[model samples]
Target: MSVDKTFYVTTPIYYVNDKPHIGHAYTTLACDVLARFKRLDGYDVKFLTGTDEHGQKVEKSAEGFGTSPQELADRNSANFRELAARLDCSNDDFIRTTEPRHIRSVQALWARLVAAGDIYVGHYEGWYSVRDEAFYGEDELVPGPNGTKHAPSGAPVEWVKEPSYFFRLSAWQDRLLAWYEANPDCIGPQSRRNEVISFVKGGLQDLSVSRTSFKWGIPVPGDDAHVMYVWLDALTNYITAIGYPDITGEFARYWPADLHMVGKDIVRFHAVYWPAFLMAAGLEPPRRVFAHGWWTNEGQKISKSVGNVIDPVALIERYGLDQVRYFLLREVPFGNDGDFSHRAMVQRMNSELANDYGNLAQRVLSMIGKNCAGQVPQHGEPGADDREMLDAAHGLLPKVRDAIDRQLFHEALEAMWGVIRAANGYVDRQAPWALKKTDPARMGTVLWVLAETVRNLALLTQAFMPAASGRLLDQLGIGPDARTLHHCGSHHALKPGTPLPAPAGVFPRFVEEEGAA
Candidate 1:
């Protein structure tokens, strides 16, 4: 990919009905890593994440807590903001559905679709799920183990008949299938794409875009009897954050997002409904929708009733911020479900961060400070071992880049760590401390190789662990700007004779104690 490409990525604006959880953090962290990577690679990147403030869930949750919807939104949205900060997320915009800009954009979209004769007033009679805020067709219903039928998507359903406005989604089925066929990468993860294609092929139903029973959402334009469906109100957040409608110039530049990172359960709305709405309004669909998997707590599904919903703030407080971020991205593949456990988090921190990356940095900086008069040594000539290590570091750049581009975050981190491991092994084999007396020139070459390897590792790890990598770069006397992903393959990031700073522990190990209490 071109380094100058513009990349627009979004995490689904989380609903504000509840406090932020591990699942929400996982999606945002994935987006953050991708955004940070793109920016480092010289892409003009826009990363959007925020809370969805208008929905029945939010209104009811507020009433249950004896607060107004706005107050509830403010509280939960603030919670999400704090959680994002704790995770070191670099989001460019935080959109709220209640913002005037969002209301205007959603209304404008509604008018455009109405003008195209794709929207009309009608009565919607179906099973509506208050928990999910979605209407389910009968075919999607399954008998639960509780002897009650529920939506297969894990939401309860209630039969409702009400006057509402509907979008002519059935009319776009053939067109959507053709678009999917033409653009195989539009929906992401071959399985998700196939599921969407099959659903479209089976047939499409007209989607109810307005709910008459809800008054807390955005009002339907010129229609007092109904409010916009939560999904319609929610998905418009993408354009609203970019100054849509009134600021056509700005909106036109980034209106069609490069990627929408969403949960797998809602992939239908993003890949199917959102695209159909865009096509009806004579706008292009988003470039891609990547649906990631969910996280269960300790191998069991998280449930509030069971008292096991993982609070994000609590996790960040227990584990350090970036430690939590690294664990989530590194623990599971982006598209597969993962089980979160305290034990697993402790293991990753001690084994990977502390033992692997942090220890290597401490060892190299200590050697340079002690042997080379606290100055970076020049890479004079490489023997067989030095050449092999250099070759290994050089080989990792492409693999890491490819993994990031493909959205395999864990794999990308793994590929980078492979170099860290190899470089550490090279140091052990060369025994630079012993060579200092017997072979000074050979020792210089080995230390040079070690310093160069550390420099490259710092560059690669910066995306995943920015704070720790920044410390690593500072110790090597390399400026922040020189640590960009583009500089990964450069042979000499640290100039000879550059004064080095004393290194500190980046990732201190977490130890579990015996029964002391």
Candidate 2:
């Protein structure tokens, strides 16, 4: 696709019941990388990420903290903003459910669905989970180790009976299945798609769209007794962000989102409920929904009670922000659960970033400083090795692009690094230092190949490791405009004889323990 095409993507708005953790950072970083990549490829991209402020959990947590819900939302929402900034997330908009725009949009959506007769006043008697802000059926309940039963949906269950509002979700099963069949890619990561499909196939009961007990959520239109269901309220943030009620010219431009990147736990909401809501409102579903996996602490599930959750800020401070981003995307396949260990993270930094990309950049820049008088070398002529290495680097652009488009982040990074590895091996075997003493022209050719490879590497890495890649490009004397994905395969990126800057270590080797290598 052309870079000029519009690509609207989002990370699920996170709940502010707790502070940001590594899992939240992982999803945001993934979206940021994709956003940066699309932008570098020259696309008009809208990347949305934000905090979901109104929910029962947030209310209870705020009460426990001895603060009002709004106060807690303000404090914790700032923490999320700081976390995003610390990780260099490039989200264009941050919507809060408490915002007026969102309130208006949710009301607008509710009115539309009600007008369409998809919503009805009803009595709800079910197992409600205040922790999850969801209601579960008997089949979805699991016996807890304790006396209390838990919702298999990852929420604590409570028996409740109240007069509330419900959406006719059960009536749309056939319609949802037809939509899925027509738009096969609507739900992503084939496994997640199959899971959602099976869940809907087994059956979808009517969804309770209001809670009488929670006052921290959006109030239902013309009904003071109930608040909008948290998911319904939360999902409206997407359209709310684009001026849903107003539908101004700018809002209409990006109405149907190109992609919604969410955690696996919320797949049903984004894929099932959100689409059903949109269909009822006479709007198109989001183009795609990608449900990625969770991150555990060294193979143990992360839990607040366990007190082992990885903090993104601490990780960024201990390592660097780019290091954190690289580790999250590179260490785990995007859609599969992976263990987070300090040892594994350090190893990846030392081996991949420090040893491979960092070493290659340091060597090439140092060689240019010493042999070529701190200037990019003039290419005398292309040899077999040079041609072969250039071809390899060129071949990677398409593969990496395709992988990224498929949302295979790890595969994309690996494909890009293959060229980095090849170029490093070529440098080691060619030994530009020795060639400089024996044959100056051959040395220039070898240095040219290495510099060219570095140029391409800088472009490819810019999306994932912007800070480090910017440093590498600065040392190579490549301009900001030259550091784009489109310029990766081209050999004319570096101007011959451009005065290169001094070499500095971009990624220092990560050391662990007292004396271990």
Candidate 3:
């Protein structure tokens, strides 16, 4: 496909100390959907995801396992890479912070910050959370059980004293506020933007940019003893993956990423610290950062201690791959917390996918096979119902594009499903099967409209469920080369008498085992 525009989207590089869970999959899948949509719409898209391997937590976890940090990172980073493939993510690149390219990029960024006078050596004494890899002020700590103090994220904090390098975060406070006010849509979901603004407004403190105590991070540019702080190193992965420091080639094309998809917990880092670092280095900040919420398993918080962490692989095994993919984005609003229940998953599959969309395709195509000699039926003439249904199918592109531009995945899916639901209603009212017996010519016209509608639905769904939608389009005689957003609507309607494959169910009804969780 020829492309004139470019889009770059990224998932927060998953921390290698942690296992790949549904949360990781959720973020990456959202990026994948957007990337695929843009590519189909004729944009040159770059979708990136990978692992963050350096930090005190990884060091501690490596010691606990009696292994070197690099060994642990290699093993775990491989798992995240596999998860992307397992989920069929169309990410163009997978980056690891430990890679030589990333090291060079991070060091280059550090040097640029130093040259800009944004970095200064200083003494640091404060509360630190190894779990969160962050420094929290005394005012931000909350009392936990047993009189222990924790960061706002509930990670335990401890007093630490060391010589460190600090980023001039306070110096950029006014500039950050001005930028936020000028670009209101840069930080997504409105609520997240407001929260970030409040934090910056309350106060700004110079951030400790290097940790003398941790040996598992990128060392500061001119000092070898103090390693760069994890967040600064981690956020650099965005520009690094796109080829920064060189300032040309991929960097020139795709820098200032179109979107950064991260969890709500790290909104402060991406929305605040990341941009400050880039702008300090005389670079453009990313276009947007969307912080999505977490997920609970069956009404309980997903915790490893509770043994309730949802595994993306297990989900795909239990349900089909496309079914699992569809449910994750559809189950909740993109920026709100959602619960995962077996009953709800089954309901969506059996009702929406199987009954509403699957049945619509199966019955229409099956009738054509039985009555129209297994070929695309030609439309007879214009009719009110036919015109209305076709118009709705054609109208979906703009609604979906608008929602997706705002990172509204659930809203975009709803817009496509609106057309699907309407097509089902049209099928019932037209009753092509009865027309096959009463009026053959009218039956052909109704079947033609339904087939065209299915073609549009399949094209829209390709971004969400590629394999299943590809199969559906195959049944409609829509070849792989013909499957793009440009091919949707009445303008690209199915050719008459085109040979079509036999209809088969794409989304099967998911059945639960009696003893299943």
Return model 3's CA RMSD, one decimal: 0.9
On a 0 to 1 TM-score scale, where does candidate 2 land against the true structure? 0.97
- Candidate 1 deviant stretches above 4 angstroms: 1-4, 145-147, 513-517
Candidate 1 vs 3: which has more lDDT: 3
Q: After superposition, how far is residue 66 of candidate 3 from its true place, in Å?
A: 0.3
Clashes of 1: 0
| Model 3 lDDT-worst window of ten | 1-10
Cα error of candidate 1 at position 514, Å: 5.3
Can you write out model 3's per-residue Cα lDDT over 8-53, one digit (the tens) per residue? 9999999998899999999999999999999999899999999999
What digit string (tens of lDDT, one per residue) describes model 2 on residues 50-78?
Answer: 99999889988888999999999998888
The TM-score values for the models, in the order shown, are 0.96, 0.97, 0.99
Cα lDDT, model 2, residue 66: 91
RMSD of each: 1.8, 1.8, 0.9
Name the top TM-score candidate.
3
Q: Write the per-residue lDDT of candidate 1 for residues 1-517, one digit (tens) a residue.
A: 4634888999999988867888898889889999998888888889999989987888888889999999999988998888788888999988888888899999999999999999999899998888888888899898876787799877777898999899999999999998998888898777898889998999899999998776899999999779999999899888888887764755676768999999999999999999999889888899899988889999898998888999888877777887888899999988888999999999999988899888888888888888888899766768788888888886777888898877889899888788889887988898989999998777878887888888888888877888888888888898866777778764545678888877677889986657621
lDDT of 2 at 283: 86
Q: Where in model 3 is the C-alpha error above 4 Å?
A: 1-3
Q: What is the lDDT of candidate 3?
A: 0.93
Question: What's the true lDDT of residue 202 in model 3?
Answer: 92
Give stretches of model 2 more than 4 Å off: 1-4, 513-517
